[model samples]
Target: MRVPLRDTVAVAAGVLAPFVAALALLPLRTSVTHTNLALLLVVVVVAVSALGNRLAGALAALSAAAWFDFFATAPYQSFHIQDRADVETAVLLLVVGLIVSQLAAYGRTMKRVAVADATHLERLHGTTRLARAGGSSADVVRRVRQELVEVLELRSCRFEYGTLIGRPPRLDPDGSVQVEGWVWDLERQGWPEGEIELRALVHGRYQGRFLMTPAPGSVPPPLEARLVAADLAAQAAAALDEDAVSAARRS
Candidate 1:
């Protein structure tokens, strides 16, 4: 379980604050007052156990035990566990801390995972909405690019058409330059040290190839983007086939 920075800070503060407070109350110490102080240290242990995970809680408990022994107990400041009862108390404190921390940590992990899952579901829902909105293949392609640029904050995107013949076209469709595929300098983007090509296809016919140059040192395209592109290609092919059938029937 990854602990958030804020939670880690809070837990550290929880562990330290009581010790600092106990130190401040040292001037008022007598035999009876010292016993109360020891009890207060135990409270700190319990609190830390409740708030942290097993490891953190156990550490906190150990820290509390050591502080109590060194600062509050008799013979005034030494780690000598002279009595059997003191050893038993320390053992009990450690066990309690471990159990509490484990439970708390598990709960925190589950909550975090649930939240992440919910956010992913929401994104999926948005993508589905975009896919369902009806439009011409070109329009749909533009919309997909726009969504990716806006939501994913990509530097640039292009769609290339695959060729049926020897080589693919190395340019974007005439009017849709900014919104479509264009030749891009791969070296500028520091991509895998080789030339890459993008091709657009509709109904098994080659449309064109687009070259993409992502920002230098940018993360690679995600699997989701590739999947979305595949889906868009399939949709465009179907749309084109339907249009061709209609045109043939009219002729």
Candidate 2:
């Protein structure tokens, strides 16, 4: 479990401040026994702040102040303050605790944001790599399926072209060609097990449909799949147009 940086710092300060105060007051030689005891008291405050939340920090601060008043002053073991300085010291300790906690919380937020940005950059890089791999529509499909299975950990994937009757031929599960307008079912073994119908786009035209069935109870397909699908759709459309042009020339 990640400890929020703010909580850690706050706790550290709470425990350290009293001992520091005692040390600073040591030169005065006001009360050797009382100062030593005050150092131990501050240590407890620090420990409490580290293990608890904002409420704990506040409680630790308050307890430290009370302990100091009761044991450190000339009026030993009493809450009465002998001077304005002592009162100010108690208030400052509480303020320090609040400040430390705030800084720690801010640090946690920044860390989370940084992680999110890194993930976005990674996806962009993957898409760019896919585009640079030139190939026929079937090759593109194969490459994409392989990438999805390997990188995205998808179980299976395929592309279909056109409507059942009028669509272009399909690249089957085994990577073989079949009649146009056929439905290709893409399946995976785990979570998010469902199917989506896709119509092939050729040269800005719809060539056919593609579909996939996610594994039972699998998590929903991530956004990356949709982005990849869009890219494949564009490639499919271009491939169909090329095929049509080739057939016309032959005829």
- Estimate, for each residue in 1-251, the C-alpha lDDT of model 2 and write its tens digit: 23446667665655555545544554543645544454455555555544545555565666566656755665766788787766666566556545554444455546655775565456445544554564455655555445444333445556665455443433332332334354333232223224444455654567655554434344433444545554554555556566668789999
lDDT of each: 0.52, 0.52
- What is the C-alpha RMSD, rounded to one decimal, of candidate 1? 10.3
> Which TM-score value belongs to model 2?
0.37
Clashing pairs in 1: 53-101, 54-101, 160-199, 160-200, 161-199, 161-200, 161-208, 162-200
Tens-digit per-residue lDDT, 1-251, candidate 1: 23346567656855685567558656755644544665666666556655654555666666766666665555557777676766666566556545655666677767766775565455445544554565455665565445444332346766554443343323222211121244434224323322233345554565444344444455444334434444444444544455557679999
Error of 1 at 138 (Å): 8.5
TM-score of each: 0.47, 0.37
Candidate 2, residue 108: the lDDT equals 52
Error in Å for residue 80 of model 2: 24
